[model samples]
Target: MNSLLPVPPRRHWSTWALLAGLLLLVITSFATLPLKWGDFFSADAVRTTADFLHGFAPPELSPNFLLKVGTATFETLAMSAIGTIIAAVFGALLALPASGRFGKAARQATRGVLNVLRSIPELVWASILLIAAGLGPFAGTLALALHTVGVLGRLFADAFENCPPLPAASLRINGAGPAATFLYATLPQCSPQMLSYTLYRWENNIRAAAILGVVGAGGLGQMLKYHLSLFQMQPAATVIIAMLLMVAAVDGLSYVLRRAMTR
Candidate 1:
């Protein structure tokens, strides 16, 4: 009876060909890179890494340095919070048109703008803004806001598009205007999703805020850069530890908020 069962179809040759192509591409990429694999694996490299890591022990616990780290941590948190707020506002505005409530031309134009805003990385945005904002948390804040706006805008538009249409249609049938229908029906359904996306983006912005400081945007990243440049490994390690703690805290908070919303 088992032998009489029909055989499963074999995968097509195209699948195998595509996989082989991908494998070859990977091999070619590794071959073309200028990496010195032998040096990376050498005993001297291992010893050097251990020695360098050893320099960071007993992180600078002095009162003055801890004060500075605390200030920088606050700045990072503020930058991410303010930037996410700004992004949430602008993203929702953009998402309205991008979701096609304003016709095809408006949708296309709005989506194009979103694409442009998001395509430029946060680091690049910070690098450009640093010249104008002049080395502070404000620059980092703006950078986070701009990039996050693009991301949140796209997610919001998708949520709006996928929202259940019956409630909106019923509202319209009962004489609700487009805006009223959206406000009374569509928005209520998708607001939770929008909030979730915003919280997720805020989580990401927190990390970006820290890294933006590397370009002198003013935060823990800036402190880390300064200490590392001067080879102050102990202080740099402290900044790194602060960054980890802050990130972990924000992640937990965002998770709790998202779960609450779902319930």
Candidate 2:
């Protein structure tokens, strides 16, 4: 049979050539403009290496430091948990209207607002809250909440968007309003997925809370900063180890929650 369509032209090499030129520019900038590699690899590097090796080999066995770490870790967990909960609750509110399962006009409006809110990062929120609330876990919690609102809102919208249409249709056919259908039909179906996603966000927030202390938010990160400032490698190593263990535990919990949601 005769072909109805014309053959497409061969692709040009100019795009590939341009990409190669950009790659070369990037390599040259890094290799030349950044720093003198030889000097950077000298005595300063040796001192850094020495500091690294001394870490956790003997480890900090200080009872005071251990007490401090324990208290800070609890605060960090509370911050992350509260942050995840705030994110889920606010995100659900925003996601409900933004998902377009309701009226189109309301959906468009809600989505536009959510887009605006979610564009900002959690760290930035923490910075701003620090200014307003002063330095502490309270500020960190607020920061976590604001960022969680954005991240969880997007996930909430996705979960809502992917929900089966049958339930929604059944509710609509019965002349049920948006609020009623959502509470009865939509929430029941989407809750499991939403819970799983929230739990995962909690895991991430734990790490974030640790870092927020660098900005005076109060957590193990602040303790880390103190050890780092004093060049106290052993204590720093202990703090780092504890942080890693906590994050690992959160990861295990996330896996369990995800499986539960699936079941």
Candidate 3:
């Protein structure tokens, strides 16, 4: 009787159809592109690539060049740190309305603002701001802050909304004011998660900050772009190495912080 029990029907056709659609899209894209597949894989191409890469060996390690790289690395770090801090403060403020704590009208309005803010990429923001800021770390920092505010605001709102309601509910039942209830009950439970989200965004902002320099927004990317344009492969390599090290250090630090906070 157990063996004869009715079997549940498999419902995997939609997944298979989705995979097939993706495969077809990829094939179509490749077929339509004017790609030089043969030249890319040719022995001569490989040799040229190797020679170009080899030119970057023994990266410029002179004291002056090292100092420049160090300064740029610090600039990038500062841009990301400041940007994330500004975003965290503003994001928390925006989250209050976005989480529907105020009212439906406020939640909708704040969410719309966040959507507009995040819709524009950081690179685009930097490019636009470079005209006004005149090409420096300041533009880069603003770009990162603006984009991060949207991201963190949305994440923070979700964290607030998903917090255990019992605490806030109890506070209200005991005659606590709205501000008091949220401050004492709701904010405490979700603070760690909000912090974790901020840290994660900071990790991304570090990488973005480095790249923003390419647009003359200031930092390691500007150094890399300048050196590369002049065919100074050694110096470019040094800048690239600095970027990698800075990113790695920030990633490690953020990971440790997030772990500690979560614990």
Instruction: Tally clashes: model 1.
Output: 0
TM for every model, in the order presented, reads 0.92, 0.80, 0.92
Alpha carbon lDDT of residue 214, candidate 2?
83
Model 2 scores a TM of 0.80
Q: Where does model 2 exceed 4 Å of error? A: 1-51, 101-105
Q: Per-residue lDDT of 128-227 in model 2, one digit per residue for the tens?
A: 8888899889989888888778778878888888889799889989999888888898889999988988888888899999999888898888888888
* lDDT score of residue 68 within candidate 1: 95
* Residue-wise C-alpha lDDT for candidate 1, range 1-263, written one tens digit per residue: 99999999999999999999999999999999999989999999999999999999989999999999999999999999999999999999999999999999999999999999999999999999988989899998999999999999999999999999999999999999999999999999999999999999989999999999999999999999999999999999999999999999999999999999999
Lowest-lDDT window of 10 residues in candidate 1? 130-139
What C-alpha RMSD separates each model from the true structure?
Answer: 2.3, 4.7, 2.2
lDDT tens digits, residues 1-263, model 3?
A: 98899998886999889999999999999999999999999999999999999999989999998999999999999999999999999999999999998899999999999998899999999999998989899999999999999999999999999999999999999999999999999999999999999999999999999999999999998998999999999999999999898889989999999999978
lDDT of 2 at 46: 80
Q: Which stretches of candidate 1 lie over 4 Å from their true place?
A: 1-20
Q: Best lDDT goes to which candidate?
A: 1
